[model samples]
Target chain A: MKRLKLFPISRRAKDLLAGKLMLLLTILAALLVLLMVAGLYLKSRPVLASQPLAELLFSTKWRPFRGQFGFFPFIMGTLWVTGVAVLIAVPLCLLTAIYLSEYAPARVREWVKPLIDILAGIPSVVFGVWGMLVVVPFIKDSVAPFFKVFSTGYSILAGGIVLAIMIFPVIIHVALEVFRAVPQEVREASLAVGATRWQTVKHVVLRKALPGVAAAIVLGIARAFGETMAVLMVVGNVAKVPGNVLDPAYPLPALIANNYGEMLSIPLYDSALMLAALILLLVILLFNLLSRAVLARVERSIR
Target chain B: MDRRKVEEGIFRVLMVLATGLILSSLVMILLTVLVKGLPYLSLEMVTQTPRGGYYLGKGGGILNAIIGSLYLAGGATLLAILFSLPVALYLNVYSRPDARFVSVCRLAFDVLNGVPSIVFGAFGFTLMIYFGLRASLLGGIIAIALLILPMLIRAMDEVIRLVPRELMDASYALGATRWETALRVVTRQALPGILTAVLIAFGRGIGDAAAVIFTAGFTDAVPTSLLRPAATLPLAIFFQLGVPVPEVQGRAYASALILTLLILIISVAARRLSRRLTRHVVK
Candidate 1:
């Protein structure tokens, strides 16, 4: 009000405001990223400081109470559970995506897609509850009996099955997108070669969509690794490294979920959880970067 | 030919089974929760504060938790929208084309999107405690706002970019100022899409429990104030009934079902509304 200037919207003011907003957002993002890095660093220092890094890296036990903190068990547990999940999910998800994209009538795809979308919208805790009551029991009574040679009770198998169910939609959504992105000529050319419908999908469509499929798989792995509630509820929460797929074992995220709230506000425990979080963040970030790279490669290859 | 037909038939069956299993999991979860918790879902559960064991049924109701969820999520959504919208607008308008600033913002948004919720919770806990807020709803709202801000900005930027450039030209040709044109014409026409972005972010915030868990420490007796601790449905599921009690477990299932239904309904509605608006604009 004090200024009746001819050009109130000065160039300097515009640039200044833009610079200030950019600085604010950058600082916030930087702080969040730094906290994650620092938190992990502080948390993992004990293990990192100990001698014989080889043993720590290769050891199967994760007895932090006695200060024997080998991450192999946790890492293996995560991979095994998620691998089994991917094994169960990938085929089913691909099939569903194919059915939706290719086989299903338009109206049917429309109906199914929204349901899948809504399924994704449901909270993870609800899935956890469902896993606890329904999935765990099914595993306990049905699958465990068949797998008694390896494990007679709740195991990674149960957790993996539940996780597969949880992540199926993500795979389907991404795969469907990739399938749709494949060019029409490829499909027609493959069909012109007298390939059956399945052959066209298997050879032409899926091969063309391989890069996207890889991205989707990596994304599914990322989601599975960070997931907490459902796995914690069904995995039996054992802290041991499993010798077989049927054995109960803990993953890093589940450990944090179960122990973070209970641990006294001590630096060691806080750092431990933070270290676990750091590991999770790093794994997820690495894969995210990998997917971006894959997408970039796909763009390049296409061009 | 017969062999190929048989193989195709088998593949079709497997496809149906795959779809069936996914659908069944969804149905099974919903049906199990509804069957177990439906009878217990009374007006009191929705209206009053939670008491002791759900069986004893002596507590007030879930009204406080519901209100806390609404306020925390609503406040977070508002802040995210408030900050991100303008920032997105500025980035769209002021930043030189292909500038380092724009790329940096894009990278930050990507990192934010990929940063896990638990990590966000830990950061919030440390930073809020450092500020002496201890665990409160404001802290939770702030944490969620951070989590949703990147997504909000990206969505808003997309919708804003979709705003036709001819409109900008028209306004400028009329001797309207830069601010006036942006505020009056472009924004007014882009309002629906922006609202859609806000709704999507709000829905995402509402369903999020990890970001809220550490920032808003769980409280049993309804949140009397923003400074006070509060229980959300997701937190309640994680904390209260995570044990082996039947009644408590029942209550948790009921709460989970309710929370899931609310989020799903709102998210679906928001997404459909946004899609409709975009389609209308395009037409």
Candidate 2:
């Protein structure tokens, strides 16, 4: 009886300890989030209040020194590059995922999946270096010349292509998981109804996996938007909105990186960079929230 | 029969191309870095410091950057592992069945992982400056810890949850304390998975660039002290890539190659370890 009593008491104490620890971690994580918000607001309040956010949003010029802080060019640059990246990545990712999950032999699937995942684990800086050396040069010497009107190189096309290469793995990984999650019987039933293998994938598998595929595409977009080193290295660091694919332009992160050191030497300039950080953070956060919502929807549909 | 065979052949070609492209990009990038870097790669290049400071063709070895990366990544991994293990265990064993808090914890990790590395860099830069830490290794370590923490939690939590329920039931029936069950039974069962988590987190710490960039000021000196400023391979590449001369730029390519090789080795090790863990689960 005494032994039994001791067992229950100890188990209860252990459970209590676990609960406390979990609570602590949860509180700590929440505090970090709060701290990040507070830090940004603390630094950016003066800039946020003194200047209208709308003008900052719509202004074509990004000269922070002269206080002409329009973010239109940076915003447009990020969207255009990411738009191109997604347009390239999504279809390739989906096709690969469908082929690997539904059509490939089991032995082939085993080998192919890991190779794709390895691409995801490679560092972005490596991609940046590779892009600057190989991809940018290739675009300059070969691809840009194809566009007769564009006389020079090191442009948006180079950056977008490199980014698309980087995010392709992510899209394939996520979409492959989605494709694999589709029940076997669903495919078997479609096939049994005399639908071709292509028809089964295009009509049934894709339809079922659309939400997950959408989530993967959105995640890819968010990743492309926030990427720094690779884009900075390959985008030519030109600080204007591009007129064509060959025109060089800077994104928000690039602006922060290029100007942060010089800005730190000046007083209000640091605050201005903080303003850029604030904007960049908010854009990423909004996209992240949207992706999570889509992911949740996918899960719900699965259940 | 002919039509069916033709369609199948087309699908096969498409699949091959899709998979082929991913591999080709990887090979292309690796070859580019290596070819550009190979001419400058030498024992002297890695062992000595840059003599010309920021100038071309005269800088010594990348020794300082390599050492700094190891020290910072090592320190960050230690801190992150300490923070993650207990938290993961608590998450798995604690909480009422209806508790909303576990879900919130999961949400927190998701949000944390989703935060851009650059934002972490900015936050670290501001906080460290405000707190008088300057651009020190501690600052970099903390920033990296924050970045790795989410991945560790998710990985460990998944492993712990995957521990078979029967093990817990048997241990409890045999009068083992819940703590004993967790430490001896559940954790032992999930050892491979936990090891995979730690390894992956370590690899991530080693490879990460953006989070450490602002916190660890690029210095030329070897980092014997964690508080001293230092450079990393990625930062070296970043700084040197902007060098005006061809020779110096070629050196940046070499440094990038070295860093890329390091990242590839570590990631391959992680993949192998994860594969082993999955195999163990099947057994």
lDDT tens per residue, model 1, A13-60: 654665577557545653556566675566567656663657755677
Which of the CAPRI classes, incorrect, acceptable, medium or high, describes model 1?
Answer: acceptable
Query: Stretches of candidate 1 above 4 Å error?
Result: A1-35, A42-68, A149-153, A265-267, A299-303, B2-9, B52-58, B96-104, B169-187, B275-283
**TM-scores of the models, in the order given:** 0.89, 0.93
| Interface root mean square deviation per prediction | 3.1, 2.6
Task: State the TM-score, rounded to 2 decimals, of chain A in model 1.
Answer: 0.86
Q: Chain A TM-scores, one per candidate?
A: 0.86, 0.90
Q: What share of the true interface contacts does candidate 2 keep?
A: 0.42
Best by lDDT: 2
Candidate 1 structure, TM-score to reference: 0.89
Strongest candidate by TM-score:
2
TM-score of chain B of 2: 0.88
